[model samples]
Target: MRVAMIGQKGLPAAYGGVERHVEELSTRLAKRGIEVTVYNRRWFSDYQKKTFQGIRVVTTPTLHTKHFDTITHTLTSTIHALITHHDIIHFHGVGPSLLSWIPRIFSPHTVVITTFHCIDRKHKKWGGFARIMLRLGEWSTCRFAHKIIAVSKTIAAYALAVYDCTAIYIPNGINPVKPITNSEQIIQNQFGLTHNNYVAVVTRLIPHKGIHHLITAFTGLNTKKKLVIVGGGHFTDLYVKRLHELTHGDKRIIFTGFQSGAALHALYEHAALVVQPSELEGLSISLLEAMNYGRPLLASDIDENREALSDYGWYFKSGNSADLARQLKKLLATPRITLERRAKIGQVYVNNLFNWDTITSDTLHLYEKLVAVKPGKKRRAVAAAFRLAK
Candidate 1:
């Protein structure tokens, strides 16, 4: 069956959770002999290649602004997707799913699927109007999709509570990691990092990610170990600058600006501990990656992270820099043997619980159900109709 995957920044997946999610899922779907065409925003995708890893890449034009980028791309991509009359059109991110109704009405026979990746409205990064639109996007996703996939149980429960829609609980997953050994030393030579001598967080440098809190906590910590922030901002320049200002010239704090591939693996492997300071998340890919690499963690005690890691590692009160400092100091004081043992358990847990292969199979099963529907018959979207008449 043919599918059009929309609403992510183009694939080769340099960064961003949504981009990575689409990249991993689409490649696996393609390998299974399914025809998948991924919509790419020309500006976000670095390369001009029309295909990657057997999946068709169709780049569409967008406004490329802070607000309009996602919506504009989703609008044009949805319109463009109609021409192909795909068997299924899968939309990622609620913001892009704002326009999902276009396909629902335009191509009545094509099943529309939306994944509730996160509650985008809760993030402080969005402006007032953007937040309101995101709220409606949430409703659009719940109402327009023939099926909805929630990346974490926390999100699934939230959707059920707020919208009274039971979204499928399909968490973000991790591939089996290849632990970096032999001291490649990219981080070491450039940043002077060594085995078990640094704390790392791989995320987008946006306000909601809570990097400022991490910097505040790390600056006051007594440990000699370094703090490595491995990500770049997404239209949050003021917050990124504020992060640097908060560091106050602490040489121990290093901003490595979005490392991936072997450099990413090196940092993950040698890190003393990986910390996720986000105030909100939809089962963080970085969190899963850290666990898959067998690294112990200290994460914000939000329900989502708790659901993701269970009792795997330490937790700090969300948004509390002082509490985070206290926790950081305490975790650092623990013996290396104890930390390594915890890391080993986390590694095994993530590999078994969040395996990408199983996630792929589960997603394909969902696709099969919709694809098997009798021709000329349209499965009604399960949620209540939107209150608005368009």
Candidate 2:
């Protein structure tokens, strides 16, 4: 089967969850003898090659602005997919799913699938207009897409409650990180961090990620250990600037702008604790990576984070800096032996639950089922009617 994946930045997957999802899922699908084409934004993917890891990478131009980048590229991609011969057109994220109706209208025969990554409208990054559009996108996804995959049970429940749509619950999966023996000095020399000497946060420096809250909480506490923030902003320049200002006087607070591969693996491996104080998430890849690396976790008490980690890690009140500070202090004071024990248990839990092979198999099964079941005449008629109405 030929599948066109739209709405992610690009492959190689340096940062974003959507990019990682596309990269992993598409490569696995290609290995299964399925033809997969990923639509990429020009800015995110610097690769001049058309193919990577057996999957076709098609780059499209977009207005590289924060608001326009995703939508413009998705618009162009959807138009391109309409003309191409593909069995399925899979869209990721709600922002791009807003245009799912375009494919439904133009190519009624092709199966359209969308994955609900999160309640993006709730994110602090979007303005009022963008949030409203995201809501409409959610609505479009529910009404137009042939099938929907929710990355978490919380997201699935939300879709069922809000849109009256039942979506398949397929949690994001993680690959196990082999322990690095040679990279210990890389962390020490570059970031002045030693094993178990600092707390690390691996996420974008956005308001919704609650990095500011973490900074506030970390600074209020009395500790010699450093706080390492390990991600860069996509379009959140003002928030990034504010983060720098918040850490201006504090030399203990380190900002390592977007480290991946061995360097990122080392950060997770050596850290005393990995904290994800995100106010919103749809099964964080970073959290899973930390767990895979056997790092003890402390996250916000949101449903998504709770569902992801269960009883394996610590939790603080969401958006409460004081509560986070208290939690941080409590975790720091805990015995190192206890922390390591919990980290081992968390690693086993992730290995059992979030296996990438399982995720790949399930996704492929869904695609096959959708392809085998032909669209009903009534459904096609309805789609044609909607096109005429438009």
Candidate 3:
């Protein structure tokens, strides 16, 4: 089957959960003998590359502004997919799903599948107008797509409650990494980090991620352990600047802007503790990666984090730097053996629950089922169902 993937930043997946999801899913689909074409924004991907990991890469231009980047690029991608003769045009995230109706209306022969990555409007990055549009995008996703996938149970329940629609619940998957032998060397060379002497956070610098809260909490505490942040800003330059400003005089805090490959694996593998203080998430890939590395975790007490971690790690009151500091101090004081044991158990639990092979097979089965349906009949059935839903 020929498929076109839209809405992710691009593949070699430097950052972002959606990018990682698309990269892994598309590569697996390609291995299964399905032809996959990923639509990438020119800014995020190398325009010269024709393919990534055997999947076709189609780079298109976007407006590059924070508001226009995703929507404009998705618009162009949708139009490109319409003329590309793809059997399935899959859109990721609510923002890109807003344009799902375009394929539904203009190219009825193509099946439209949308995955709700998160309730993006909740993120502080969006303005009032963008938030309204994202809300409408959620509406359009429910009404226009042939199938919807939710990355978390929380997201699935939200879709059902708000839209009266049942979406397929498919959580994100994680691949196990080989143990980095030179972890200490890698950390020392990159960020002057000593093995088991740092708390690591791997996420894009954004308001919703709550890195500011973490910075505040970490700096308040008098500890020798370094707080190493392992990501860069997307379009939030001001926010990133503020984060740096927060740690201006603190030598213990390190901002290693976007590490991947061995360096990233080393950071996770050798960390004393991994922290995720995000206020909102749709199944964090970073959290899962941390678990895979068998690192003890500390996260904000948000429903999404609780859903993923589920008593496997320590938690603190959301957005409360004092509570975070308290939790951090307590966890830091705990014996290393206890933390490693907890991390090992959590790793085994997550490995069994979230396997990429199973997720890829399930997704492929869904695609095959959708492809087998007669186009005209499928359209009528969807239209009728949508009307009844209204």
Candidate 4:
């Protein structure tokens, strides 16, 4: 089936979980013989439309501002979608949801599905006006879309509680990567990370990500384990500077910026344990990758993380540095388990739950149901599908 996958940022997945999700899912779907067109905002003056992994990458015009960029891109992409006859239009994020109104208004025959990754207003980056616009978009889209995909049961519960919509739960999936090149020594030398002597925290440097708490916790830990922070922020100077000041010039906590490819793989391989200290998450892809690599996880106690990891890793109180430090110390004090056992369990969890094949099959099943129904009558179609599932 022909599908249009819309994301705020274009594919090739520069950053963010949704972008990565689109990239991996689209590639896998294409291999399964589904035609996928991904719409991405052209960030650079020289950005050109290209194809990657048999998926068509369409670069559309967008306002580069934080508030208007998504809206502008959605409007333009809506125009594109309306003109292009596709079996379904799958939108990621609330930005595209603003234009969900358009498809119903114009081309009611096209199946429009959306996955609300996070509650927009609750995000720390948004301002008052931006938050209002986002909530408005969410209301408009969720009220009209054919189906809603929530990444976690927590998010699904939030959707029902807040939006009063019953969304299907389809958690994020990750492409597994086995350790390839041995670049640990090179990365260590470049970033000054000691071999096997540091804990790694990989996430965007956002307030809600709880990096500040992680740093504070790391500083108080009794053991000699250092903290290696990986990732960049939209407000890089503000957060990077704040994180540095919080650490107080102690070189124990190192910000290695954004590392990907072999370097990132190497870091994960040599990490004592991978920590995700986000205050909130909709099933973190990073945590999944860490688990796939078989590194024990030390994450904030949140519903989604708990749901994802369960007993596979250790959890600490969210945003509580003292509690986090205590947990880290306790884990450090405990003796290490056999690597083979840890790796085996991790692989099983990923293969059973987070594999792309399973996720894509479920996605296509939803798409088929959406496509079978006539346009402007989505609620009935959704009702029928739920009934059929039961």
Residue 220's lDDT in candidate 4: 72
lDDT of 4 by residue, 1-390 (tens): 899987548777866788888888888899989899988877722446488889988887888876778888888887887798887888888767877766665666788899978776777777898888888777765686779998889989988887788999988987777657656776667887655688898888988899999888887766777888989886456876788889988777888887777888888877887889998787898899888888878888899898888778888989899999898887777667753366458757876799877888888888888787767565655554345335
Q: What RMSD value applies to candidate 1?
A: 2.1
lDDT of each: 0.88, 0.90, 0.90, 0.80
Give the winner by lDDT: 1 or 4: 1
Count of backbone collisions in candidate 1: 0
Stretches of candidate 1 exceeding 4 Å from the true structure: 180-182, 374-390
RMSD to the native, candidate 2? 1.7
Specify the highest-TM-score model's number: 2
Ranking by lDDT: 2, 3, 1, 4
Q: What is the lDDT of candidate 4?
A: 0.80
TM-score: model 2 vs. ground truth: 0.97
Candidate with better lDDT, 3 vs 4: 3
Cα distance off (Å), candidate 3, residue 387: 5.2
Q: Evaluate model 1: give its TM-score.
A: 0.96
- lDDT tens digits, residues 1-390, model 3? 999999998878878899999999999999999999998887885656898888999987789999899999999998998888899999999999988878776777789999999999999998999999999999988988889999999999999999997899898989977765777898888788888989999999999999999999999887899999999998899999999999868999988999899999999989999999999999999998999889999998888788888867889999998999999989999999999998899999889888888899999999999999836755675575457447
Spell out the clash pairs found in candidate 2: none
